[model samples]
Target: MPAPHSRSASTSVLASGSQVQPIQTPNVPLDRSLLLMSLAEEFFDAAHSIAPSVTLSRTGENVEVYEKLISTGLACLDTALSHVRLAPRVEANIRLRYAGVLYEETENFMEAEIALSKGIALCDRNHYYDLKYAMQLLLAQFMFKKSPKASLKALDSYISNAEAYQHISWVYALRFERAAHSLESSSLTDYHAALQNLRSIAKLAGEQNDRPIYMMASLMEAMAHLKSTGPESMEHAQRAIAAVWAYQLDSDNRIPQLLGLAHILDVACSLRQGNPTVMINKLKLMQTMMDEALRDPTWSTTSNVIAIPINRAQNSSQVVSPDTRTVLGIGNDGRDNLMLSFVSKKDAFSITYLLCGMVFLHRNSTSDQKGFKYLETGLNSLEADMRAPRASSGVLPDCIATLQWRGQIMCYLNCYMAFCAAAITDWATAKGHIEKVETTARDFDVPLVGPLGSVLVYLTGVYYQGIGDLDTALEIFQGKTFELPAETGKTNMMNSADQVERDIALLAALNSLWILQDGDRKNPSRNTTLIARLEPLCKSHPNKDIETAFNLVMATVETHPAAALFQVKNCLRAALNGAQTTANTQFLCITLSVMCNRFFSNVVGAQAEKSAQAASVQAQKSGNILWRSVADGMLAQCYEVNGKAADAKFTRDHAFKLAQMALPDI
Candidate 1:
């Protein structure tokens, strides 16, 4: 793969392998300098090309080859540096670039970032734009993940240097990196500018080299169109997906291709206006294949520097929910993998939203039981991020929205966990956690406008919903202010498929409201105006989540015992099945157990009996003491449900006894 190393690249006095005899500066340094310098330049170029092979082998086999290559390259460079006629700055710039290559190859990101920064600075200071361009490319991968701010500076320099070099691809790559770091508040100007830069690069795009960058840029632009346009967004998305497929992007840039495609399809599905479901299925298949493609190879992606504020690209593209990236097989670092190996913190930042969206999407996507683990794992992973962000411990003011949003997710997370505990009748912990969720939500203000609105509505409703007040949750869920058309969090960063998740979150929020709203409508929450406010949505969407929730609400109502049973069973079967598949088993269990208990009106024996059954089921599956107690307590309630007064009293004693057995301290 390498051009042959030639002996002519170096000149020798005595000819023992071009080994330099010490030079005296005074005599005749500039005499044959032109010829020697030319030769030295060729060797330096060769060394740069051969440098990456150091990573290829550790065995004796290519060891000498790499060593010889480096030595030859270094020998020529050493001679060049030693040239008495050369300026000190010129020699230092060259040496600095070589050091950058070394630090980069060794996976020493900190030193690498430092070296490359200094080297590029040296190039800038000397006005050597071409050399700066080359080294800037080397520094690209580090920009977004480690330091978006610094990355932007480097990328700016890279772009300036690139323009001088007339390397169009470099500009496109820089745009992509810029888009990666765009924050929620970042305006459409950033998106537009990035798109403009990308389009400019596409003008110079060619087919001979299999233009992955062109394909990727096209895909990104198409998605951007979805957000910014109405009638044309679909057309752009369709055209983008087609280009990727037609260009056989599957084999070339499979990861970005499938991800982009998945994003569009997911958005379409979430919009729920067309046959987006079929497209979502097809996208999943492509995604699987894409994952397979990334199996063996690890490609290099160096970030570019851009000093200008990222211009908003056209968001005509469908707002992709953040969920599309978390699907495993995306080759996330394994738990054991060193955290330092990550390419960019921005990349990691993007993943968190995607994970949240996945959980949301999974809960709503299907009734299939198989999807549960995926959803749960994603949520757990999202929950795991409660630890402070790794990029920096100090939260920047710009990230307050992110922090609050995270708190909102925690509210949902805690509720989901509480529901799970309740499902098995694990009352004690479930009650405590649910109360905690209530407290968290109370402290949080659901802003009337912005991303937090929808989430706030969802979180507030879920808390009340968890506490057996589905009516109130439904009223809140109906607030359109909270319904973001897409993953608002990704206002700039890649708007992967987030709409689907939003739809699901809506469903859960409404379910909380309607299910907890009691049947005592004579007072009708006693608020006729409130009930009227929800009539429009119920008429349109037919109140799906709340439909079941309403039934659960009625189940708990004093008047309709059988209807309540039916409603509780209906909610349990559907919600449980849905939650199980999405890996949101906790939600499934919580809804079921909570609904079941509500129907019994917190009757002593009934609550214990129902909980006991669910707990038994859990124990068989997990062998946990908490689950066992729930089952035992509920079994005691079954005695009361049997209408035996003495048996009921006896069951209570046994219930207390079982609770102690299951929880020693309690």
Candidate 2:
């Protein structure tokens, strides 16, 4: 008899090298079962090449060809497991393969794991690399969603096997092909390196004609790279953008959204590089691409836009309808707010983006009349959009999310304006803006706001402190806050990750001083625990944000004038070393200025020593005079207060000179 044709076979299923008839299971086993087995196994070899055909015997009705094909494959396992100890190698492998699928379908994880493992072990132990790769492929998929840790460990075990086996050629795929799962594991720390590996995989995939796998690999690699901003990060971002351009896609491929994000990175990088042309182009590209995406049918719904609340309204029409103005009974664009009586106009994403953009725009564009007007118009549009209905008819598109949280973005934008206003001593405006910010913050699951919320919570303490409400402010400064945890898998290595508990504790402590009665907020009456909680953090992580949190407690709560000055100087000096644009540095310096002028802050001798130390450190170059001047002035006051007549005159002269050099505006 000729050899049968087939490739895939399960434990009891036998695929052969040629098409053949399926043998019936006999109740009276008088015939040679092996002959029937050989015929039944041939279908798999050419399973993809030839169409399936069904045939009925005298005892049966004609079944569909596909159904007959699946049944034939499945029947191989039905009776083979009972006699696995007696079966030949090929028979056992076929039976084990089929049995694995059945066990998995029935949620018999242990049975499936054992059957697959045994088949794989046999192939692996015998240097059957191709079969081993196939087995690994099947096994990993099952484990990835369940025991990722175990799957990762097992994959490492098989890597050596892949390299040693002769049958698995270089052309054969890697048995340990789970780079993503590896990246998601605690074993694989470092987002930057993970990004490089993913990029390499995407590059390797580009050489292959496997459209689905290659494209998927490219997208996954792109997302992984973007999630972690690393060295030459823009290159990975550009690669992702280029991947999208490689294929002409008509629909929203998600690849274009990535491409748009690459544009944002390009814009920011260009802005930093002082190339306004490149920055403008990238910014325009981002806006254009985002606008295009807003019209995407598949992603046009709120669920899809919820992740990017600011992006949904990029394609929406006018913010204020002509009909809306008429219905409100207001004259054209008079004193009335544009959004006062308007219906829903935009989603959350749109509102968040416009507001944040307006912040930087305001700082950079007040000189341009047209640009200033555009900023106000943008703000009006945002408010109108925010008033839009969350859902329609209670039957939202499948793509729209039912719940959304964008408080961090809103808070940052609002607080940004408030902060700038406060820094410039425009207290009335700052106070009004912060009040709005407080309202917006109530909308989110607080700790989920990440670093942005942390900054806001910290700043709220400063605002109260700035208003001379020291006791109230001290409680805010000492409030407990949960540090938001990393959103990526716990395995991703990133410095300074915050946990929810930490942020909660930090915020809670800050809130305490503000919420407590006057007696509790005074320095002498303050809780001893605040210093205990803060002192350890300052000692353990001298350069971390925790240290700044500690400094905040001292600056607001401590009654010792000299100690508050010392704490502020310590924070400012540390800021000189840390290369980050955190609000910590600004808060530290500003609070220092306010502290130095306080009646209780009269310790002159120590102030002079610390101020002299701060001026010499070039690292705290904030491009502002506030830091150095405050330090210099404190030094001058220290000499005067201690009655060092000559030193006081010299210090005062140096303070003026340094203040002039540090800030032209001041």
Candidate 3:
């Protein structure tokens, strides 16, 4: 017999010749079992030579090692299985080794499954029960990607047969993983199962005084509640925050990840409560925590568009923690998790930038441009990262995963841009963004009108309305809304059912207002139905600005000119004060136009006229041609009321010129 050939590192070292003993060749032929074991050892040694651990790869050089390992492993396993016969023990070990190598080194799930299934069968038939549970666990986990229900069944079988062998953490981790997967579907049964799993973990953690587990479980439970729109979601979020505060000690980083999550949940709950001020504060805190996490030099740099471990808190929190046990290592796991290559620091940064930008856009309209700039930078970084060659997708193709995220981000960014453009009467810009989003939705196979669909549609209608295409706008506003799909990619302001409802209410109200202005006073019944729908939506939500707009529309529908004048005056005062203001130029123009109508009808006082004049000056300074036209028209009406006929004619002609310039080209 001769020694097996070694293709890797050389065993010959001349400098240490005295200490090194001569290798001896056996005279007998090697047994099948020994040869199989030797092959497995050689495969692992070759793999380890390039990578410290099979799971971690910090450099491109390690990727080359993985490719080499896969090729060698496949060849060796194929030769051994084809030509050799071995004892049950050796056979089971070889199959398991082959399965692990295939799973880690390549995307060939079929081969891996065949090897794992064979290994599992060997363990079962020979009563080699020690490896059975581990093999089942791996198989079940893999099945989670293909079929969650099948994975759940396997998990149940494994638990039933090997309860004593499973670790406590493993038990909880599996349950959490199942619950997380169940959320992908819209079935109530799945939601109930997820809730039950979280509740069980929460109860056990509470009983054992395990604050960390309790914190994570409670947060997840809060998210589950949010998915179902449960009444107790906010309370659960508060409880999670309390748990963190209770166990947290001031140290290095001070549990930044936990604190960041708590703050994010707080922002979500606050938004649901319609508390913009509170949401803004929470967003600021979350930004601070994320900045601290990114500043830590220990975190590994990633090549992919790393989603901040903080997703919109739903859709996918897997990026937050690799597994349940790793949740405890939040800030610490950033680098190690990035090495896994599923997420990157840029993903996290983009999300934080987006949230902060949202606060600026909503809370302070004056800073809306700043918000757009922030979102633009985030989106650009995301696109660049996604197109990078080194990016990895865990189970799906990297390009497909990148497209999904790109579609998701563009959906929100374009929607927000539409709102900003519509506010300033930039109809062309607004329409362009909406069209891009519509195309993106179609290309990505996402719904154009799901949870956020109504808002997108509403914005489209508003753009038409701004251009004086009232009939087109009305048709769109009154279009039928389809039922939403069970799974939309992600949940946020741009894609939530609540946002859709709110937008629908506003759209309907605006449509009715347009009908009344079009001199369709003969159709009071239709107008009444629209007003009736708008009243409830406006009253239910505590957004003062929206309520103000609703009030103005309601007064117009009721033909109460004085009341309309009062609302317009209030809007002007707020816009001037810049506190709780509806400072949008287009809306200001509408209010001023309403005031001009009231003045011509002898329905307003001297103070109302003065306020209207002030609003006109502000609108003229806004740089939107449509609003400038509306403002000039209001001034022309004021001149006519004051009996200045010559001045009125000159101003009316100027208003007409501005209106013509503002109109969109057919």
Candidate 4:
């Protein structure tokens, strides 16, 4: 199975409910000034008090309350600003507050931007430098998800303004935003520059005793390291874990959103280390922490912004409806209710479940049921989040952002589900899941590029191969039929995308080789030619699992009986080593079956029987119907050779039943 790589999306700042509508100059009674200001302040306070509820609300009721309060506040603030003889700074502050509310609570981005620009104008006229820079920062943050280039431009402008005013904190904040935007670009130079900026911020913040800024910078630094791939990757992951631990230890100042994000990074780092057991345990602990946080009333009240680093799909044109019943066959139907029961709150921690499922699939497990359950839960939670009232097409930035993140996740889950289904020889379900993946990528306009496209193409080949269409499967594996762009230019030796592309190509080539060797037994030179081509590529791409597979294929072509037996044993050792290191059950089963067949052909009944039994046990553990049937069939033949007639008949019948289950037409 192709491993999914984690990528970060453009940083997006959540809106703070403090912005309002533009104020018009109008005549009003003198006595009404203080009264209107007081009323506006009261409404603003009311809205701020419930703002956290709006953030976490599953239903629209809390949102309705926050919107009503902010709407009323905007009206009062507008009345006061129109006629009152208020100080310029005071009026500017009110406008900033109104704009925040409009942008955050109501999602009225146009009104919020207009009010913010007006507020900045007022601050400029009065020389209110602090308020002016603050509003500018807010405006830049607001533009990040909608227009990253525009956001960076705004940040550059504000950084200069802050430096001119000698506001060190504002300057640091503006520079941090600029660095974050730089990290979004797919340029090595930009990445290095972003890292440098973060390092500088961390150093200056620590020297100035700004612990919060220092911690944030440290976290960002860790994230940058996590995204990178090289000999230093594990070192960086360890550093990330250490940074997260330090942040967690600050008991006096715990921000739930930050803490949650930090904990996720911790889990991701653990995953990168390749210790499945430790990673799973950490995921469980993180889930407990999330549960505790959700139960705390204070968790929802903080106004701190949360910018998740999930990768979003490209070119999302419309909001996909949350009703997944038709697409996923999940609903009030009892058949899938057990799967849906695992669904939890759709938040940062929900991603842990998806990670856990991936881990389970990667490990050498007997059954994929546990992994399937975790993936189902994660998918359901994402669907539930997408179904939230705020995830509508009219919300623009929020809607598109939500679609991108969730849609990308959905694609991964669906692809993995297809793999699991194929393992069990559940062809219909496997095809359905693959179709779902394709539809999702198309619906969300997710570009099928790099590793994602590779995975999809590989799985399509698997689907065809499983259904007995060897010709089509061979075409797909050879990349002769898929419409995806060919890998071009010099490959980055350390780049994960390059690595995955190579891995997929190698796997496809291996599969194609297998088909040709089986289909054209008389054409020995063709197999030799293919092996010559694959040997160096395998040497270049040095994956343990792929190497094990390549060795097994090599063993098949040895013409001499003695050489073939020796080579098969050597390949078995390699397969066993791969099983221990990579936990690839499929490789072990294939290798053992080949060894059994070699022994049987060489007239070694007892050795063949032993190998067949071992193969059968592994096949059963892997939950792969095709492998299980093959192993059982081999075992039955071994029994017949041993003169155990009753055992042979019973085993043969069972093997036939399993073969029918795997392929009904056969």
What do the candidate models score in CA lDDT, each in turn?
0.44, 0.44, 0.57, 0.65
lDDT of 3 by residue, 208-306 (tens): 454555666776776766554444555665665565666556453243445556666666666555555676678777777778778864344444422
lDDT of 4 by residue, 1-666 (tens): 000100000011001122221232356434455667666666655555444334434245555555555567678878777777777766776787677656655656777788888888887788666566657766886787678778877787777765565455555656777787887776777778778778877776666555555666777777777766655765865675576567676764455555666667777777666555676787787777887777765443212223211111121111111211211121232111000111123545457667767777766453747877778888887777655543211222233445565677888888887887887788999899899988988877677777788898999999999988888897788775333234333443235565566667778887777777664443567677767777776642335667777877777763322244565677667766765566667777877788777656435467777778999998888888888999999888888878888998999999999999998876
- In order, what is each prediction's RMSD in angstroms? 15.2, 19.9, 9.5, 12.5
Q: Give stretches of model 1 more than 4 Å off.
A: 1-127, 134-161, 177-185, 206-210, 222-235, 249-280, 283-287, 299-368, 376-528, 531-666
Best candidate, TM-score: 4
Per-residue alpha-carbon lDDT of model 1 for 1-666, expressed as tens digits? 322332232233215334433443666553344445444445444434443332222234434544454456445555664654555355545455444444433345765566557666776778654345445655766555566667666676767755565443335444555554442214556656666655655554543232554555566666566554234456666666565566654453344423434454444433332233443455455445444434433322221111111122232011111111111011222111101112222222223333333433434323232223343453465456544233231112213334455456655555555544444344565666656655665554323233333443455555554454556666776565445343223422333333323444546534533453445433444333433343343322322343343333333333322334564466466555544433433344345455445545335555555554664454434323343455445555666566766866765675566566555543
Residue 11, model 2: lDDT of 28
Kindly indicate the candidate among 3 and 4 with the higher lDDT.
4
Q: Per-residue lDDT of 1-666 in model 2, one digit per residue for the tens? A: 011222232222443322224443455442333543443444333222222111111112222332344456445454454443333445435544554444332355665667677877676556443344555655765676688767756665555554443222211223215565665653335344445545544554444332323444455555555444344444665576566556535342243334444444445444333233454565666667667756655333333321111111221122212222211112232311111111121333344254335433422322232322433444455556445543332111111112223344455556666655554444565677667766765543334355665666666666665555666666566545433222423422432233323444554564554344356335543545555554543443422445544455554554433355565666545543322323233444544454454422456565545644444232133323345566666666666777877987886787687666544443
**Runs with alpha carbons beyond 4 Å of true place in candidate 2:** 1-197, 209-256, 268-386, 389-403, 432-435, 444-449, 470-475, 478-666
Cα TM-score per model: 0.42, 0.40, 0.67, 0.71
Which predicted model would earn the best lDDT?
A: 4
Assess the local accuracy of residue 548 in candidate 1 as a C-alpha lDDT between 0 and 100.
40
Off by over 4 Å in 4: 1-126, 135-168, 208-212, 270-273, 298-304, 307-345, 364-368, 385-395, 441-450, 480-502, 521-537, 540-544, 557-571, 599-602
The clash numbers for all candidates, in the given order, read: 69, 73, 8, 13
